[model samples]
Target: MSQDPSTEVVARELRGNILLVMINNPPVNALGVAVRCGIVAAIDAADADPAVQAVLIIGTGRNFIAGADIREFGKPPLPPSLPDVCNRIEACSKPVVAAIHGAALGGGLEIALAAHYRLAATDVKLGLPEVQLGLMPGAGGTQRTPRLIGAKAALDLMLSGRHMGAEEAHALGLVDRLGHSNDILADGLAYTQELLATHAPVRRTRDAQALSDRQANRASIEAVRAETGKKSRGLFSPLKIVEAVEAALDKSFDEGLRIERELFLQCLDSAQRAGLIHAFFAEREVLKAPETRNTKPRAIAHVGVVGGGTMGAGIAVAVLDAGLSVTMIERDEAALARGHAHIEKVYNGLIAKGRMTTDAKAANLARFVGSTSYDALAPADIVIEAVFEDMAVKQAVFAELDRVCKPGAVLATNTSYLDIDVIAASISRPADVVGLHFFSPANIMKLLEIVVPAKVSADVVATAFELAKKLHKVPVRAGVCDGFIGNRILAAYRMAADYMMEDGASPYQIDQAVRDFGYPMGPFQVSDLAGGDIGWATRKRKAATRDPRARYVQIADRICERGWFGQKTGRGYYLYPEGARTGTPDPEIEAIIDAERARAGITPRSFTNEEIMRRYMAAMINEGANVVHQRIALRPLDVDVTFLYGYGFPRHRGGPMKYADTLGLPKVLADIREFAKEDPLFWQPSPLLVELVERGANFDSLNKSE
Candidate 1:
């Protein structure tokens, strides 16, 4: 082994006739400028050495190299760009072998592709995931990947940005050998020695014949373009990826490299790229809570779930999937049996769809037990009540949990919009009570709003975050409020849509406009999927407290009065015929909207899609600002993350707050003030928004201050 402090990022040592190059950048070995230069220097030294017959490359820590250094994003270009380094490695005179473990993604995978041969551990992951950041791989990945694998296969890997395991990569010819040893260096050295003994020639991927026949793959390439066009919607990178792949098949290697570079630069300069990068950072930032930063989380082995309805069964499944034993309690024997049946039906559906094996379902079910008695929860490390949303029901459940749960057991409530503080106070051990608001279909949704009450301890908050991590969920800390962050904001924007419907715009038009903004479904479409009865119940609960002077749209209530409760009833805003999941526009909804507008003594005015989106976004941003101002949310990014995960906020626009920041705060404030002229009650600008605009700052400034 050789030691050199100057080139510590990329260390080198010679083993027999093999030159071993190890990238020593810690924490995933991100390819920064220093690491890129070091790799180039190491390869140059190996090529110049007379005794070296083969070169082996690997990473020092847990990962080979995850991707480019995100810290370098939006900065000035540095010398020896990644493309230059990759080309240098590919042009080496001696045979080069790359031994990868952990994740070799984006530029890391691009560098590996430049090598003559690739070997990986059985547990390794390899991918070109740059498209997720709104950019395709720039460093010859577009040109070289299709040459190793066909254009269709390369497009599938690049466009989806999904990581492929070693077994799959080996099947696809990306990896030549799989090592079973944990000692990657030893395995790499052995592979290198075998290659030297066999006298393997320096095979360049640039010379591969995988993509030489452009005529043969033209149909496949066009099909990819059409599919990506629909799937990507407002995204700019997926189409660029298609163009680059087409270049690989139709043009020479250098020509394709030129086109790829052009397309990559276009993606880098796009607004979508900036938004996606913000989203990527914001997701990581929401986890850094000041209260939980240094606190030690309590260990949880067994969990107790109260309730066995849809939400309860989903929660139990999520817990059991995380390898925790769960005891689910219901009100009676029949209810408990139904809950057990609901959970079993879920797994059986998965098994039927080939998503789960029979043995896996049996093992998961083994961790789950159903009972009607609260006494079974005595051994639980934590207890979560997923019962009815009513205050009385939640309080009674918590009281029972307080009586039966072991001391120090954390008590949590899965209330979406109730006052969690009151619930905590209802319990004997208020300090151990927290609110864990899991979105609908809890096992599938990523967002878990961790509502911390006034008396909860810091360690309990830390434990909630730890639990979220175990369940593969994103946790955002929220203070007690009527709707917390996501639902609070959701309530505001949903009202705005209702107002728009009464004014003139149809629900279908509003949905199409929001869809054009890149959401998978608009607000009404979401209501249909989730069932409108859920919203109807919430409205009925809040009807007594609603301000008399505020504008109320009764069109939705009119629909629900007829028992048209959305997908469940085959009718809501749109009609679902014959139990179909999708719904078409219904003329009856137009009549209800017109009747509501006439009854309110208001004249309807036509609204352009552009105006509709502006009003909708303004409403969302105004409430998001209030969420931060009231301290219901820790930071602006928390609000962003909640919407991004819970609701279908377009990730390419960042979260709503990030999108507001991209649009200047002053502009957003001006829009709110203008809209206030028509309805001052609903369009009132948030004090935080006004303060931010007056001080010439933005939501991101609040995130930084925190």
Candidate 2:
């Protein structure tokens, strides 16, 4: 340990003939300027010392180095850039060994790749994940990774931004040795001593012949390019990563390094990079709300899930996977059996795919219990009711939970649209009643909307957020409303699509435009997958209270009347022939749209893809602004995080609110004013948006003020 406080971040010690240099930057040991300069000075001193035969580099904390200091992003360049420090280490006379424990990512992985040898713990994850931030690695990662591993492997790792385990790294020759012990220093020192005894030559990754089969690798590179182009349609960084890796094989190492730096700078200058970075920060920011930040969460261990249907089963699986005991309650013995089968089916699928062993499945299932009576849930710390979506049904379930569950046990409803406040008011203990709205296929999706009712206590809300963290779900606090955050915004935008279809655009054209805008699928396609019947039901439910003067399109209802629900029914707006997953456009839907337009006495007009997106995004942003203005969402970033995680709002655009801020709120308000001439009711700009535009402020201003 260093006695001097100034030099404490990087400490050096001599262990016999080998020099041990450990980076002491806490948390993730990010590669800031100070750490970079410290490593450079330490390496220079190690080379000058006559007694030191080799050098071993490791981190003092959990991670070797996670990445660059993100706080320095979008700032002026500092002295001793990461690439410069990497070059200095690579050119050192003595062999430098990198001992990676937790993560070696981005600039961290680049530093490791530049070392003479690499050793990693068995659970360590290594990657160049800069593409996730809309930038390729700049510190010679593109040039050095391909030289250590083949060109195809390096391109895949960089493009997908996926982490590789230590065993996989060793198999790919990226890590020279795999350490079994948790002590990274001991394993690294043993390897260093063995290398010195064997008189092993210093292995420079830049001089390696890993990419010898350039022609054969070119085919795979082309395949990956086509795949990335399809998957990452509107993104800039993945393609840039492909270019950088291709240069690695086709050009000299120094030339490849130059190309990587140039492409990385280009990504940095792009707007997509800004949006992605905002998205990265906004996810963490959404959890810092006042309700949950200061309050301590109630302890929760055992979870009770009511219902064994799709959503209920998925929630059960999620809780069980989080290492909490689960008790599933159903109404009867047959229903309990069905729920048990549903849980078993999920594990059985994983077993058939060789993703899980029989023992692991058995162990996971052992933590799960199924009962037909609600009395079995008496011991649960939290009980979530995933019953039907009707108000009466949810009320009855909560009443039963109130009677059977223990005092202080959290009682939650998973209703997507029904008013949670009504459900809370029906129960005697309203403080325990909150909404834990998990999206469809809850185990797979990451978003969890925590709906806070007027009667719910602060600690209960805090407990829900704590449970979200335990389940590895992104929890967004939402005030109790019809659809809360995601579904409410979704309803607004879907209506916009409907109005566009009646006015000018075809459903297929609108969907195609949305896909072009960066979403994996368009609104109509998502409707088809989720079953068109769901929207039909919501429309029918609201028809009794809907404003008569408000323009309402009946095309979807007309289709639902014909029993063409969606993928499950084999027919919808699109056709899914022979049980196929993807759908083809149906002419009948166009006829229905035309008939609806004729009934409304409207002339059809042509809408370009750009126009469609303008209208689509305007409605989304307008509704998101309302969500923030109404305090349904605590801040604008909360709305952004909700959509980014739940809905297929593209991460590259940084969700609707962030995208609106990037486009300038004044421009968005202007677009809304322009559209209001056609339909005054729907296109009326949000008051907060109009107020912000007049005050020369932005939605981010609201985020910061909150």
Candidate 3:
């Protein structure tokens, strides 16, 4: 063990021929800057010792360095890059072996590749997932991986970002051997001794004479270019990965790494990386901003859930799965019984699948207790009001929870768009009221947006973040505002879609445009699936309470007025014959759009799908800038996470806001200003965006300041 906790690296000389090196950093063994330095120093120590004939590198805890400390990303990369470390390791005369047990990701995988040989524990999984985070592996991954695994295999691994288990890795020739630890030091020592005896003269993978096959065929390179052309349509980096691979195949080892670094630097300069890094930081930052840090929290072991609707049932199921005892409270016998039956059916379905054993299913269900009274809930640790989204009714529920619940009990409301501060004002203990916005099918979706009202205590924020960790969900902190960050950004973008509809674009055309741009669905289709009436209800609420210019959409209201309700009503954008869910666009709506355009004496010109996509994305980025200016969301990544997880953003495209970085700020501002000429109030460029554009910056540069 090292002399200090801050810098810990396990080291020992074994039997005069084996040098055992282990990373002993506690808590996930994060490869922080200090750990990196320690590792470099350890390698120096191993090299200087004449007694050391072989070195074994392994991690002490669950696994090796999970990845580089993501916190350090964008904040100037540390010296002694993983590739440099790997180069030093391989160039050593003594054979180096990597003992990988759990995960060897990003830098971890890079380190393993640096070693002359690698042995794996049977359950370990490995991969290079930097592409997912808008990064290609910087440390010789593009070069060395292809050297070990062929070009085709390496390209798929880099592009698809799929991970493999130990056995699969062995089958693919990534791992030299797979075994369990019979005796910790003994196993690694034994492996090292066997390697030392072979005198195999550690073959540097970079020195391989040939592919043992031929170079990539012409058709293969063309196919890769075409695939990248489609996949990274607007972005520059994924295709750049293909370029790096091509360089790897054509150049010498040193030459290939130089090409890899060149490509890596190019990606580092990209807006996609900036946007993605923004999103990555936002998810982490939201956990402890001052919104709910001081509020006294109740012990959340037991929760009383009110409402038995879809939201209620889902909340109940999630709370139970989190190992909290749930007393599901409903209005009457029918609702109570229905809620119980629904929870049972969900658990039963899980049992039917091989996912959950019958015994485990029963045990999980036993944690749930359904009742029809507020009397028993008064003593519960928490009471969550997952009722319908009506302010007066929600206020009444808050009043009831305030009256019925014990002191210090957390009073939460699961309202998607209502102001959490206003909901908190309804109760005397306003600090106790916070927003817990769980996406539908809560257990399946990983995002849990925790919104803090203006007067919320710091302790509450910490508790919420901690609770998110316990639930195994990513908790993003949001400040009090209408719809918080996610929906507020959507409000502007969704409204833009409606305006585009009136401005000579069809609903189907807009939907197709968005889907082509990489969103899972178009705004209109989402409105239909989410139900037009809900938008109508939210609009009516805004109309009654807020200013006329409080960012509202009315075209959908007119559609709802005609009873063109989505899905459940079986007639929405398109007609749903008999039992179909998604309907075709109704021709009548085109007539309504035409009539509205003529009534307003507006010129309607045909727009190509390209213009529609550019406008929609521009609107979303504009709103994201507005939200950041308003300080509703901490950073750009928070907005990215909001859209990516909540709104079904194409993961590979890296969410809308991050995707915008690829479009460049100046171009987006130009487009927004052009749109503003058409609709002054709606299309006015965000001041934040104007400044960013003026500064020739992307979201990433601004985020560094945050």
Task: List the candidates ranked by TM-score, beginning with the highest.
Answer: 1, 2, 3
- Candidate number with greatest TM-score: 1
| Tens digit per residue, CA lDDT, model 1, 113-218 | 9999999998788899988889999999999988988888899999999999998888888888999799888888898888888888999999888876777678
Q: What lDDT does each candidate get?
A: 0.91, 0.90, 0.77
- Better-scoring candidate (TM-score), 1 or 2: 1
The digit string of per-residue lDDT tens for model 3 on 1-706 reads 1334444654444566777787776655667777777667667766787877778888887886677776677677777676777788778777888888777888888888888888888757688877777779888888888777777777778877778788887887887887766444566677777877777577676765334454453345557778878866666677888888777777788998998998989998876676566566666655545544565444578888888877788888877888888888888989999988878777888878877788876787888887787776876777778888988989988887888888878777888988888888878998777788887776667788888788776666666666667677877777788888788888877778877777778889999988886776788788777788988888877776666664443567677898888877777776777858767878887777788777666687788999988888888899888888888877776787778778877665556666777777888899988887867888888998888877788886655666
Estimate, for each residue in 1-706, the C-alpha lDDT of model 2 and write its tens digit.
2323445677888999988988988889998878887888788878899988899999988899999998798899888988899989999999999988998999999999999999999879899999999999998998999888887889989988999998889999999998978889999999999999999877888898888888877887788899999888889999998898889889998899899889999999999999899889888887875678679988999999999998999999999889999999998999989988988998899899998899988888999999988899999999999987789988999889989989899999999999988989998999998999999889889999999999898999999999999999999999888899999989888999999999989999999999888888899889888888888888889989999888899889999999999899998989999998999999988899888899999999999999998889999999989998999998999999998889888999888998998999888899999999989998989998989999999888887787
The candidate that wins on lDDT is 1
Candidate 2 residue 390 C-alpha distance from true site, Å: 1.0
What are the models' TM-scores?
A: 0.98, 0.97, 0.82
| Alpha-carbon lDDT of model 3 | 0.77
Please report, as a residue range, the 10-residue window in candidate 2 with the lowest summed lDDT: 1-10
